[model samples]
Target: MPDTLYDALIARVRSSTKARVVVEAAALTGGLIDRGLIRSVVDLDRGEVDAIFDELTRGRVLQAVGKNRWRFHHELLREVAAELSPPSVQRRLHIRIADALVAGAADGTPEWPQVAHHYEKAQRFDEAASAYQKASINARQRGALIESQNHLARALENVERLPASHARDLHEVDIRLERGFLSSTATGHASAEAAAEFERCLQLISDEPGLALYATFSGLWSYYATRGDLRRATQLVEALRLRLADMPDWYRAATDAVFGSLAVFRGEFDSARAILEAAALAVESLDSAEIEGAWFAPNDPVAGMYTFVGFTRFIQGDLAGAEESFTKMERRCQTLPFPHGPFTLCYGHTIESLIRTEAGQTDRAAQLLGDVAAIGQQAGFDEWVMIAASAGANTSSRSPVAGGARDPAALEEHIQNLTVVVEAWRAAELISFLCWYDAALAQTLLAAGRKEEARDRVDLALQMAQETDWHIYDAELLRIRAQTHDCADAVEADLRAALELARRQGALVFELRAAADAFRWGGEPHRAELLAVLDRFPAGQDWPDLARLRSLVG
Candidate 1:
């Protein structure tokens, strides 16, 4: 019945070829047409075109949206009218309409989606891909990362349909690189999906030297680093150094930041501090606008570089230095582009909060946690949300362990929730902080007096750290491991090892922590050793670890 009614409408316009042209124009352009678009495609004068549209509207086939525009009264009528034209004619009309729209773009920026749509319908894949890419960029500028990704996906899909050639391969590489960056921003740098995109780009990116290096560093090196594979990460750093040596000063600085982070992961605190500080200084000398275009990573390079510097300082017990670095990092975040800016801020806040909590500055920690949660929620970053929630679990007042409140069931529930979240992160390949999370979980378990479970968790964390050569948290983990053992001999051996490792790493904070744990566990036997580590801190500093150590000895 719908088809019969549509055919009657079409038959009414059949006597006038120009009127038929108007129906096809309305049908082809998404069931809507203005006088300009109709006049562009048809030979009728503007007045005649207006008359035809008015007649169509009066006949109930088209509805007037305004004085100059008309649309099909029903979608079914538009579909039937669109099909009335032969495929060849339809393709021609699509191209003509697309070209007219491009010509009519008053602001010089064509409506990319509409232009791409018409070109795609015309089987003009090249134009379609380019327009789609523009659309993707427009979406990205608006902070709609997911929408940007969809547009890029469409661009890639359309570009792939074109014949295979070197140019096509390069085009695909460009699209994939953009997609990889978006994936890294939306999910995580170490996510499997982001890795896959860069891996594919690496295969096709040989001709583009800059892009090849980016793919290798961002894809392969990042994957290994996050998964605790520091050996591979070191290898990649060496490769990056040689490739980057002659490039430029900025490249050298970027490489320094990368190597510095690797050093931090390996527990080489002193060297990591120097390298990261030098990199930060180099970046700090540049204007934000200069860094924005030159620094070639998904996130703000300076912010990330400073974050590692902050960690290095914190571990080395340079509390003031660490706070300064974190403040700098947060300040850098404000100038960054969308998604990257927010993500970097969230990440910096989360890590800073962890440090604050450890320093026993609960009020500052709470404020940072609030910042992290707000940024994560505003940016629609699920991983950030999970990470912030997980970080807060142990510190929340209801938890029996880290929190002052002692509800065993509440602590157990927080532990269970944290386990699920961290494991989910593991499943997603967001393993950059897996060891830290595991150790934290173990500490909470020990506080709850579940020694066996604590030991089990500590063992797994240690294994992961050893396997990946990620030793930044080894001293703390060892301290926790020592607590889990019931045998005095075993506990003494672990504590001694933890102290030695912390001292060698120049990780004064960890050394103090291990010393406190030792003094508490070994009583009088460990008192002298604990006092020696305590003297390393400046007198009268309000570090929670120091206060705890003082109370124990006095």
Candidate 2:
């Protein structure tokens, strides 16, 4: 925790280029090791600590050699203590700056920092430049514009730094997207390739224990998300969850948020909420997510647990509440420029509609749905889905539907917000979510009296479900199946299967939705049966069906 300890770690890391170790130590000490030019974090007792302090005042570490009073031969001190004093452990601090210079620097920038003759220093500019470029590319891909810009500036600071080499092209693409230009598949491909390259760089630093894990987490997130392999993504996330078990409590929130997202995708909103409870209430960027190594609580610094708590306040019908989150998100997350996913915004909007609908403000709900449709139209695909019993859903509730026919003006306003799904998918792009889209299409067609088309859409939705390993979300598609049914027995069987599936997965949310469909398709007897099952489902949800649930409850 001493200033000397902090400086020692920085100094050693400068020579060694193994920053992960320093960061690991920082993580271990709960960040007490930062702030000062402390040479290193030592577990010295009273007498020994005092002796080191006395020596520090006289510039004992390096004053004779013109080195700063803060500088020290950390490795040498450990040797001396080992021979003549109380027991101690010391590390050959390897600075990542050294490695970055070796790997990336072409020339300039190292002179100012003044690495001693004993330090084998190369140029420092290139590594920072290269890291900036790589980070910029990743940040842009994940839509972190500010973060990308910050890194771009760092890379550019190196006078000899080449024009954004590895991810140069991507650098521009992110800029274009920020300016609202349409991004192409070629651009997406470039982004993915850039990501893979960054991953390779990270793996090269495998000697740094905790850093390697984050690089691993990054590679896996992009890979499975791109492939739509939620199953594999879920598994890897679970592994990270277990891996971070002994980590500091501060690190727990970020890891859990990622894990909770998979749970949401897997239709586990309950689990997702539980994990998100930490982040949702607190309002800030989860920097703790990247802090690596065997985690120990950082000393005395207040983290954002309080802020996350404020962020999570919402009711089922609060569209205003939902919008409030977006406001908070924009405010709290301003500095976290790119490589982060748009999961928060997209998910926030999705829940906004649900909450608005649940609050009986169907018009506002419809507007929200239209807003998302526009995002999908422009962004290529709105590639988000609520899947598991884990974590995920949107909310903040208020209702215009509390009155009989709803507030006429609000209803009109909501209707005005609807986006005509003139095309089969967003803009001209193929749908990323076939099952959900197809199922939704079938319902629209059925309502519009296009029964034949409805039946076909439903059939396709079901077929897609049968082929995918993500059989869990297959329930969304199953709603279409009942409409395809002509016989009582067929309808009954489908309803029964869906009900069973919902219960098996703890998909009470979706189950409640399906109960409404069952009432429509199952007729009097099945409606009675489904309603009874629906009784166990939580009463509130941000959807039109909340009305049905309300009616049933009454």
TM-score for every candidate vs. truth? Answer: 0.84, 0.50
Off by over 4 Å in 2: 1-191, 198-208, 268-343, 354-362, 366-434, 449-452, 466-468, 471-473, 520-524, 527-534, 537-544, 552-554
lDDT of 2 by residue, 1-554 (tens): 45665455445435432332333323222212221222233333445434444444353332222332222334444332223211221122223323333333346433212121102122344444454555556555665455555655555455233354534433332222222211212133113443444454344443343434543453444345334566666776666666665555554565565555555545454455566665554414434444322111110011222122212223212223445555654443333322122323343444454444444555665665555555434434434321100011111112322333334353443222221231323343322243444554455444444567667766755554454333435565565566666787877677677766765655564565567667766556656656666566443434445555647535
Q: Best TM-score goes to which candidate?
A: 1
lDDT of 2 at 231: 69
Q: Which ten residues in a row have the lowest lDDT in candidate 2?
A: 388-397
lDDT for each of the candidates? 0.77, 0.42
Off by over 4 Å in 1: 1-26, 37-62, 73-77, 80-89, 106-110, 140-146, 245-249, 287-298, 397-430, 486-489, 519-535, 538-541, 550-554
Output the lDDT of residue 326, model 1: 90
Report the error of model 2 at residue 419, Å: 14
Where is model 1 poorest over a 10-residue stretch in terms of lDDT?
Answer: 397-406
Clashes of each: 0, 64
**Candidate 2 has what TM-score?**
0.50
